[model samples]
Target: MKVVAADSSSAILNEKFDPLTIVATAAVLVDSPYREARGSLPEPIYADANKGYEVIVHEAELCLNLLEKTKADVVHLDISLGAISLEELSPIQFTNMKISTLGKQHLLKILPRIRKIAGEITRKYGIEVLAIGKESIPVRIAELTSGANAILYACEKTLKENQPVLLGLPSKCQPRISDESAYLYSLMAAEHDVRGFAADQSGVLEKVHISEVLNPIARGFRALRIEPKT
Candidate 1:
């Protein structure tokens, strides 16, 4: 089945590698044998990292926006709530679920907005938006897609501000630059062919120097040091 999924990934990091802002959010359409995105819509939000839960709203909105341009059998969200139908999800449903206190509170705050968009997708397209989260391969693709695009956005930021920017990439992914595009390939086993890429049509990759380093405190996660070419 064709799947559309959305995720926000990558973040601007402080000197201690703490994330300061989320760098990009993306929605992607994936077909069978889904190892990569067939089509994608990516946006650079640069939103506060402490309010990460709010990004879910933007992710759902991105899924709806992508639906306007293409069709999918289902939509997957990064909510991780047992793949429940988001349209039918209610705040009361949280009582039975085994989620942390903070997680439940965050979901409660965003439920109205997410439910509104979920209802719209169902009524307008007759497809269910599942809170499948990371279990869905399509959602992973969306994460990598957003991470790849985040690199471009980070480079642009460094150049615009003429300073170095520390970027934390999604976990278990390695980045490569080729053909004027930046790609983040999933390093997880059995996902050798799965990758997400963003084109650098403005030649931004050439205008910056990027160095990859392992995040000291976050195992399996990597960071990039981006500096404008002098």
Candidate 2:
């Protein structure tokens, strides 16, 4: 069982992050030092007013295209597109939720096309998409009204369906906890869904950067890390 703890003086973002310059990306560093655990606190803690980590939301192909054209060393992704299809912003899910939604997101209808597009794009450019998200437990990556099956099944349809390349990703833990390492962790997690990425240090979350109401986990790669322009 994991717990969300709050601490100001020793939060990782405060201690490790460069407060003066904006935190653009993080690298995985390892030492014998382990993160110190703080006392368990209640949920929805809003002591800090920071907007949490800034995230960029765009289609998967758009992201990949950016990566290739720039030839940048690293790219970060957060799956949270923000209630993509939902009408009510107050109760948005899956980043792109739309109006009058009731059941699971239409994964079956969209997944195939989305995967096909990604496959075609990947094939043409060999662009690598970095997958990031919380360690979800039966959590739908996004909301679905009907296309859920195809969205998931699209995995098999793609050429990289079961390739060794598919079993790679940076890390498996929540994004903010390992703020500095999220980028590296994400790279490994992209390779392996269950790789269980390791971090150099353990630290607490400051309410300043993390909002009380945001679903950091449900946000996916869109909500996980920064978009570095290289």
Q: Of the candidates shown, which would achieve the greatest TM-score relative to the real structure?
A: 1
lDDT of 2 at 133: 28
Q: What lDDT tens digits, residue by residue, belong to model 2 across residues 70-154?
A: 3322222332333121111122333444323422243323444444544554566454333232222111121110011111111
What's the alpha carbon RMSD for model 2?
19.2
| Per-model TM against the reference | 0.98, 0.23
**Candidate 1 residue-wise lDDT, 18-105, digit = tens:** 9999999999999989999999999999999999999999999999999999999999999899999998898888999989999999
Query: lDDT of each model, Cα atoms only?
Result: 0.95, 0.24
TM-score of 1: 0.98
Model 1 weakest 10-residue run by lDDT:
173-182
Per-residue error (Å), model 1, residue 87:
1.2
